[model samples]
Target: MGSRICVFLRRAGWTMWLAVLMLGPAQFANAASPDPSLVAKINAATFEVVIPRADNDPLSYEKPLPLDLLPYQERTDKYFSVGTAFAIGHNHYVTAGHVLLAAVGDLTGAPALRDANGHVYAIDKVEKFSLQQDFVMFSLKEQPQGNAALATDTKAALNSVVYAVGNALGTGVVIRDGLYTSDTPEDENGRWKWMRFSAAASPGNSGGPLLDQNGKVIGVVLMKSPNENLNYALPIGVVLGAPDNMAVMDKRITYQLDVMEDTQTSTFKAQFPLPVSYADFSAAYMKLLYAQGDEQLKKLLQQQGNDLFPHGAGSNHILHDTPELSLFPELIVRNRSGQWSYTGRELNRVPLSGNGYVASGYVGHNFLIHLRRPDDMKVATFYNDPKQMMDLILKTGYWTREVGPEKIKITSLGNPASSTTYTDNWLRHWKVFVWSLPYINGQMEVFALPVPDGLAIMMRMNSSMGTHDSLADMKALTDFFNVDYGGTLAQWKEFLADSSLLPEVLRDAHIGFDYGKHFSYDAGNISFDYPSTLQPIAPDNMLFMGVGYYQDHGKFALQPGVIQVRLNSTDPDRISAKRHIAPSPDLDDNFKEAWGKLLHKQHPYDGVPYNDGDEMDVASVIDPPASDAPAELYTAFYGTQGTHKPEAMKAKLKLLTQQFKLKTH
Candidate 1:
């Protein structure tokens, strides 16, 4: 009896273990079945929007228009084409902010929102709006009856399956189910955090409710991924927690409006500002030079070669050998308003020329400073700061010039006492200079041949004009100018001063350069990894579907279609529908089976026309009369190639044509 009892107990234990292994572990009781009726009821609460075109009145005008005005110049009515909304309260509807923004314009031009039953409703007022989150709440003039409103729930269990019922892709009412995903922080536009999910939401689905298994509203379907099955929603808890008072709503609205207006205004200003006159530009240029560092100063000088010498030698002579000398200085007399009235002195000295030509020019007089190199056409200097360098270059009448292939020369005027002229093509390159002079209305200028290719050099010359009657008289006046030989100086200067300036000039000057090693191109193309199935969409037109899944809210995603097409087409007037055909859920299994069959098949061209070595024969068999092939067969072949070794197949085709002369024959 004891042995029998023990046997019975062991047998029961083994049975229990087998049952546990078969059934797996127990789960929570929250796995309630989804109610299809609830989805239908929720969908019934949603409405399709239709916008009517505005009438054109050619004779009507607020103000008398000119008879010569163009047709496009006349103000025409604007209207919204399509949008979506859902009932939230007795007389309130919720939709995306962008949907209602266009409807809030001038009443005469604004469009009326039409419901599914052709009932036209006026937007009484927008109760709340969040631009960042793309949400809008508006009250209707009258509410429709017989619609079942969903009850909002603040807390939803994580990973719970949820259903999104809305007019996806303008296909009327549809349902998509997926589990709750995660949430992202509020965006920069004061939008609340976004709740992420796997349920798909497409065009015309915004403002629809995401329902739980119990038929409660868990979130508002807002966005979705364009390339994937990811979706996002606005949590119902956040919507319920939002401020409901009029004062609070008004403050929020005003703040957002201000922020948007400020941003738009700033962008406009940056893109298109008031133009500056030539005279005003000169003054600003001077101020900029004064504010720059040594490196920037040198660069500024190097950029504005010939604009500093209006009456001096032409650019060809002024810039002849001095590739580095951007501008030459001239003295001029000016009135109280800073207008030049007379010439004081002009300093004409080409670098390494060994000749000093001076003309009487006054203070404040504008002159041209010229710079030219064989490789680069010409450039001129138009303005200078601190004005000291201009004074020295003008007074000294000694400029540096380049002589041989790669040599700099220094030339000096014949001394009256010594009656000797000296020219040194191999003068020791002086990277520094210091000079002091007695006060006078005279100016000095400096010039040099292409200063070590890209290296820019800054110079300063000061004078203690003995004593003057007033500060104005003693003030050191200088101007830099560039001389263009054939109107090429301006273009060169503009190119050098462009905002996208090269970085090579700004690099440390201590590093020596090998002139022989200079090359034409410096940067390479930008490359990155991207999924083969994904493609960029045009943002201006067509309709966006499933754009809320990814963190990128404004961008559209990949589309599932026979031939891939961008979510948004380039045309602004065209509306596109999301293609319904997609791979079956058992796509992976189907692919494996199909691929195995293809791998086992023998080549049909093995004994075709010509020898086996002739690739044309293989191509002929594979491409066998497209007209005779069924559409499905073509699709299968193309699709299979696209799925496996696409690049390799392309290369093989190219090789057959290029190397085997298949196409040429």
Candidate 2:
């Protein structure tokens, strides 16, 4: 979701990164290993950045992660090492910015440093940071004894012998020799340069010191050039010379919604007084980040108004959709004439306890979902619990821990570590839950919206990187997601009672229904009511509410896009009222033909009956008011297997449209 942070996406960049990290057996120019005294000095200064392991119930696996997969001491350690860092001015410690950000939203124990002796020290405050350069300078709560500060150097000659020093693969701090190959300008504005080197750095090597032949810190080892052996580091001078007491997010993040082909770029920068605690720093940074993300998202939708969904040539089919009410959560895919249309998936279902089945499918990379509730699960109970949801996911073989020869099954995700709610732009409410899979360094994020039958869930699984990435990404992706809510009168009563679960619009809206008698819905802007005379008013009949762009009093906003009342699933006797936005460029032939038919008073949009067709229906359009606004249409329709005459159709439509007015006040 934030490809802006993609630069930091090199968490564990596969074997190619490892290839560059392990720089092979040969030292560049046949240089000797550093002196034992210098090695001791470097080792003393280095420490691994780590997060303590969560106290998990022994995972339900046929065979556990072999204790032998790791060194005896490491496997027995109390904390999990992530990256590396080293001391400079007694208390001043420096590491890669991305390494420090792992703590930004991590609910795990605070980010700390662990030494070779297994002593851990907590970080006290951030002194300086540069996202573009990918570096951070901070200090410890209490400095470790016996570790001397690192001597710094600003430059290293090209082709000179050097060493990549850090806890490679989290094994422990080790020194690997290589060449200080060359220099390349930094990507943004050529403000600084990156020291390209061929050194044996690894996943745990990041944020550790890149040292010169004399054992002086020349740079902070960062990332590897994926296509070549020339890996990179930030010259130590940059970290040393950065302005005192400041933090800057000067990175370029490219954000694109799934619905839009175009991307928006934010040179996202937020500078503030530093010397701040990690908690405050993280909170402040995220607050600013989400603000930017929200603004950018809105701008993207408006800027592409002409080409975005409901406007472009590709979205033609959706405008005319009469697809059956679906319980399977579907994604909007850009069709040929389908600038956007719901994806009909080929899902694989796995049975769970209590007659529940997990229907799983891949929407795109790393994105997945399960549709509706199991026959035996309760709407309120299952919708309110996240563990039950993930436990079902685990049953499908989706959540597994692979260690040595074992693909260990995780029977339960336990309770969620964090749970909250996110409201989308369309005023749709979704419940958000995050589960930590500590063994895999992974997190699973779930966003569940209540549908008529049950919940339509969208989930994201991310691993190896910091656990917060999944949470941050899922929240952003919620905006681009699609869902429709409806249910039998009984389901609606239970669902609507939880005001905290309702979107703003719905929190104030009401639906009053009495089985075998009448059904009614009333929101501030729209209302509809009906009796058994108009249609079958039963508890099991489906009533659906959709969200979309509504033109109101000269301003466009999100409101219930449509209100549909179906007497039953099989009956052709149904009533619907919906709004249509006039296309921007008016390019698509479908829209052209649609507008032609509407203007000429043709079959579907005209108040007359076209009974010979499969879609036998009568409809009338209420044009937008003559006020400051774009062209819009509100149509009330009645479709049945009963009548063929215009008068009969109009009579039913009149009953349907009596309360379907756009009330401005």
Winner by TM-score = 2
Give the lDDT of residue 495 in candidate 1: 35
lDDT of 2 by residue, 1-665 (tens): 10111112221111101111111111123235577677667667777777776666434654555658755655676665556788887789998887777656554567888776777898899889887888889988887898578899886788998898765554445677889988888776888888888886666567878888898999988887666667788899999999889988778887676544577887887788899988887787877777777677667767877765545566545544433345566666664443676764646877666545667675653345655556577866678788776666667765555444455666777888789888776567888887765554556678887665566788765652433544555565565555667766666777787776676657777888878787787875667787778787886677787765444665545466677878775676778877565554635577667766655557677777777556568788765456454355577888887446667777877787776767652
On the 0 to 100 scale, the lDDT of residue 392 in model 2 is 63
Candidate 1, residue 250: Cα displacement in angstroms equals 13
- Candidate 2 Cα errors over 4 Å, as ranges: 1-31, 56-71, 141-147, 170-173, 274-295, 298-302, 305-317, 320-324, 333-338, 343-346, 351-356, 362-370, 417-427, 436-443, 461-480, 484-665
User: For model 1, what is the alpha-carbon lDDT of residue 135?
Assistant: 57
Total backbone clashes of candidate 2, pairs 3 or more residues apart or in separate chains = 9
Tens-place lDDT per residue, model 1, 1-665, is 00000001011001100000000011111223257565455544565443433343211122333333423312231222345666765665666544543333111333344544456666565555444455556565656656446676778887888877655544445666788877766543444667778876656456567777687878767666666666777787766665452212111111111001111111101011112322232233223322322233234334433322222222112111212112222322323332322232334434412221222222331223332222322222222221322332334333322112221222221211111111112221211222221111112223221221111222222221211111111121222211111112222234335322222221211211122221011111111111212222222111111100011134321111111112232322211111111122333465444433333333432212222231222221122133432211111111111222435434433332221111110
Worst 10 residues of 1 by lDDT: 16-25
lDDT of model 2 at position 498: 74
- Top candidate on lDDT is 2
